[model samples]
Target: MIISNIAAPLLGLVDTAIIGHLPQSIYLSGVALGAMITSFTYLLCMFLRMTTTAEIAHAFGARRSDLAQQTTTHAVVIAAVLGLAIILLRPVILQLAWAVIEPDPELQRYASQYIDIRLWAAPAALINLVVLGILLGRQQAKYAMGLVIFTNAVNVVADIILIIGLDLNVVGAAWASVLAETSTAALGLWLIRDLLPPWRQWHITPAYFKQFGAMNRDVFIRSLLLQFCMAVMTGYAARFGAVTVAANAVLMQFLMLISLGLDGIAYAIEALLGAARGQGSRHKIRLWMRLCALWSLLFACAYSVVFWGFGDGIIRLLTDLPEVIQTAKLYLPWLIIMPLLGHWSYYFDGVYIGLGLTRAMRNTMAISVLGVFVPTWLISQQWLAEEHANHGLWLALSLFLLARGVTQWFYLKRHQRRLST
Candidate 1:
């Protein structure tokens, strides 16, 4: 799981590295914003992954082979449909995304180049999400790792050839990603052939379908809230001008690398926690939570040190633009603080989801977004309205992290109490 999750972000790292050396910094920055918008869109549909994992894991644990099969089928079908819908809504999504950033005409043109080309990969990307979820559910960690490695490897190679060699610019970078993801989706589906039953025998039972639908709904809502926060974060970053936005984009890539790396641990927690819950071992749940928290904090501290120590060099590697480097250096401290406060919520999210506590997760996220995240963002915007808009953006984001950790802790305690009773 660790390798699988890590590989995906390494792909992005490679992309960033290549683009960082591009002749124009604007192209790099445009790719960053464009990537964020695309990522935000894909993340909004992430329930295809999360809900499928929980449903398939539970079904398999309960010894219901038919239900397990149906879960995978339903996930693929729904993901396909949703992906098509996103493609159809591409113009609308692009319009809204542009409204948020409102970049200059040239950068906007580049962003559109990236977004429009990448939109074609929507169905493949979403299906890949479902395939990953199904693999994790079946405890096929190695398979998942292989798929991610293969996908990212192709992406890196393609990115090099297209962006550097062919000089297709942003469009090359975007198309590289699309091709890699599409290949991954195809390969992942093929790899799961043995696990799936024959097509003729497949049918969704009403009871299993209802359960699957509810899980999907919960995860969909939870993911929406999560993605909304990310969209706002990206949008806010863009308001600070191209240099600021680019710096934030570089910093965010690093943050995501940390977050997703830690997620490998969380993914382990989710798998083990789900297994423990299946066995009705309440004590195991507590144990998993404690271990996850302990490990997360340790890793967070380690990440903080690495980023603090080598951040300047890292930023330099990403871009040669003096302003982008200078701005990213200014923001380095917050990058250090982020993992310390942010890692907990991610771990808790996995634990709760593994326990099938989606309602609590959803409700807490709702409160965090409305009560904590949005208000802090607005306040920060007002406070830094004249100069230093990025300051407000970072502060508001920090508050959002604090809110997530606090709220999730509250609900997790309540969950423990219920389990005890």
Candidate 2:
């Protein structure tokens, strides 16, 4: 799980390194913003991946091969449908992003170029999400790791050849990702053939359909709310000008790397927690939560130090642009502080999912979005308009992290007590 999560950002690191060296800063900013747009879109369907693992793992623990097969079929069907929907809605989505971010004309053009090419890979990307989830559920961690590594390795090489050798610019980066993801999806299908039932038996029964529908609806709502918050945050970043947006983008990569790496541990907890939940082992549930919390804090602190001490140098190595570097430096503290507050929220999310507390997760996130995120963002925007706008953006984002963490922890503690009683 660690290697799987790290491979993603490592792919971004390659793009950052290559694009950062381009002769112009606009291209760098363009790629960063473009990538963010793609990520936001892709992650909206992330529950396809997450829910699959949780459900399949639970089913596997119960020795229900039929249910596991049904889960895989449902996940694949949902992913394909969602992927198609995204492709169809590409124009509307991009238009909304443009309206919100309002990038410079040149940057906008580059963004469109990147999005246009990458959009074609939507089906493959979503399918890959389910594929990875199924593999993780089967406890094929090494295979899962290999699939991600293979995809990103291809991406890095393709990125270098397209961007540096062929001068395809931003489009090159996008194309590289599309190709890499497609390869990963194909390879993933081949690897997990044993887990899949025969093609003749692949049909969703009425009862199975009802359960799958419920899972899809619950998980989709949860993911949509999360993605909406992220989109709003990105919009705020974009409002601050290209350099500010670019700086935040670069800082975002670090956050992704750290958050996702920690998510590996969370994934482990989800698997264990789901299995315990299946067996109705309350003691094991508590044990998983405690161990995850302890490890989460330790990892968060270690990541914070790495970000504080080595982050600037890492940014400098990515790009030689003085302005971008300077902009990133001002906001470096947020990057360091983020893991401390943010990691717990992610960890708790896995725990909640394992306990089949999707409704609680959804409700807590909605409340945070309404009561915490919106008000804090509005206040920050007001302050920015008054003076020192850039600082206001960072402040707003930091508040979002703190709020999310606090609220999630609150709910989880309550849930823990309820379970105890």
Candidate 3:
């Protein structure tokens, strides 16, 4: 899981490297801005992935294969509808993004070019999310890992061939992602062909949608809150000028890389805890939580040490732009400290998803974003000068992670106490 997750972010790293080395830095900034917005939209729809994983895992634990199958089918259907809706509303979405991100006109043009191409893959991408959820739910981590690794491997190769070989630039990057996602979706379906319901046997009823709607509503809101924080970070960075946003893009990639690596353990926790919860094994759930936390702590410390020692070289590897490199250096300390500060939140996310305690998840995110992060950021802006505009953003992000992890811990302990009683 860790290996495959690492490969996933390396695709983004490849994109950043490809564009960062271009003669103009605008290409890199434009792609970064566009990708952030794209991620925001997809993440808002991420309930398809989380709820599917939780529900299917629960069904598997309860020995209800039929329910598991139905869960995947319903998730895919919902994903398809939402994906198509995104395509249909592209104009409005772009207009809204333009107002929020406020990219420079040239950067906006390049970003729009990339977004136009990539949006077509929405249906494929969302369906693939369901495929992954099924794979994870069934305790088929190896298959899920293989699928992710394969998808990223294809994406990297296509990105090189189209972007560097054909000189297609940003357009090539977008097309590369589109081809990769669509092809992977097909591969995922083929890989799970036996597990999927036969076309003739498949039936959708109002009850299925109702169940899905109920399960996903809280998950959707949780995801929206999370993604909104990210959007605000990216949007605010763009307001600081292209250099600030570009440098932030590089740093954010570092954060993503770390998150994905840690998520390997988180994914394991989700599977284990979900199954345990399904079977009413509170002891098993506690065991998984303890073990996952221990591993997460060790990994987080190791990453922090590595980032602190060799962070500069990593930045150089991402971009050749002198300004971007220097700007990234100014905020390098945050990257060093972030893993230890932020990793607990990532671990908590997996536990919450596994337990399907999404209302708690939603509440924590609201408190972190609105109650803690935003207020802290506003305060920081007043005290700091305009040149260090991003200091507050970084501070807010750290505080948000800390708040989330702490809040989740409180909730989990309370639940455990009640269970014991």
Candidate 4:
């Protein structure tokens, strides 16, 4: 699971590596901005994955085979509709992003080019998310992991061929992702063919639809806020200059690597907890949480140490540009501090997913983003000079993570009280 999860971020790392070595920093900057926008958009629909997993996991755990089948059917249908909607509405989405990001003409040209090409794969990309959730929800970790590895392997190979061998640059990178996603969705459907009910057997019930909408609504809002925070960071980075954007992009790849790897533990927790919840085993659920927390804390510490000790060496490997490297090094301290502050949220996120506490998750994320992240960002900007905007951005992000974990803990405690009473 960890290996597969880590490979997902390797796509970003590969893109940065290929584009970073381009003749000009503008190429890297353009791809970075475009990629962030695409990522945010895709993640905004991540309710498909998160909610599907929760629904299917509970159904599977309770041995409700019919309900499990129905959930999968509904999930796929929802993904298809949402994916098509994104494709049709992409122009509006792009326009809104452009207004907020406000990139220069050169950056705008490259970003628009990348986004336009990538948007065509929306249906395939969304179905892939549902497939992933279904597989993991059934506790098919090896299979889920295999699919992730397969998709990313194709992506990496395509990236090298298109970006370097053909010199296709940013367009090549976007096409590589599109091809990878479309292929993976096809492969996923084939793998789960037997598990999915036949068309005649599959029918959506209003009761199921209501549950689906309710669950997805909470997760959708939570995901929107989470992605908004990240999108805002990149948007703000663009304000500093292409060099700053490029530097932050490089650092973001490293952060993605860490987060995705740790997410494996969280993913496992989700499956286990979901099953436990379905079984109504309080003791088992608490035990799983405690053990996962210990292991996660140790992993978090190791990540912090690695970043603190090897930050410079890693920065050099990410980009050849002296200016980007220098700027990244200047901001290395925040990266080192981030793992410690943010790791808890990752664990709690898995817990919430498993227990189907998404409304609580939604509420916590709302408070964190609206109450903690925005205020802290505004204050940090005023307190620090313009030259230190990157520092302020990182600070705001760190606080957001801290708030998410803290707020979730409060909710969890309240939930426990209700259960106990």
Find the candidate with the highest lDDT and give its number: 4
Clashing pairs in 3: none
lDDT of 3 by residue, 374-416 (tens): 8988898889899977988999888888898998889888977
Pitting candidate 1 against candidate 3, the one with the higher TM-score is: 3
Residue 151 lDDT in candidate 1: 89
lDDT of each: 0.80, 0.79, 0.84, 0.87
CA displacement after TM-score superposition, residue 132 of candidate 3 (Å): 1.3
* Superposed model 3: Cα runs more than 4 Å off: 6-8
Looking at model 3, which ten-residue stretch has the lowest summed lDDT?
Answer: 3-12
| Tens-digit lDDT track of model 1 for 1-421 | 7677764456556777788787677887778878878888888787778777776666656667766677777788788888899899999999998877687778788888898888888999899988988887777889999998898889988998999899898989899999898999999989877656777876667886787788778778888888788766656676667877788888878777786768877777777777676667778878987888898888888988888898888888878878788888888888888888788888887887788888888888889888988887787777775566677777777778778889999988886788679
Best by TM-score: 4
- Judged by lDDT relative to the true structure, which candidate is superior, 2 or 4? 4
- Candidate 4 residue 41 C-alpha distance from true site, Å: 0.4
Q: What is the TM-score of each candidate against the true structure?
A: 0.95, 0.95, 0.97, 0.97
lDDT string, candidate 2, 1-421, tens digits: 6776654556556677788889888788788877777878888777787788888778867778877888888888778888888889899978988988887798899888888778788989998988888877776789989998899889988998999899998988989988998888889888877767788877778897787667667767877877667666555677677777777777777777786768888787877887787777788888988998899889999999988889988888888888889988887887888888788777877887677777777777777777877777777777666336666655656666667678878987787688669
* Pick by lDDT: 1 or 2, better one: 1
Which regions of candidate 4 deviate over 4 angstroms?
none
Which portions of model 1 show Cα errors greater than 4 Å? none
Q: Score residue 84 of candidate 3 by CA lDDT.
A: 99
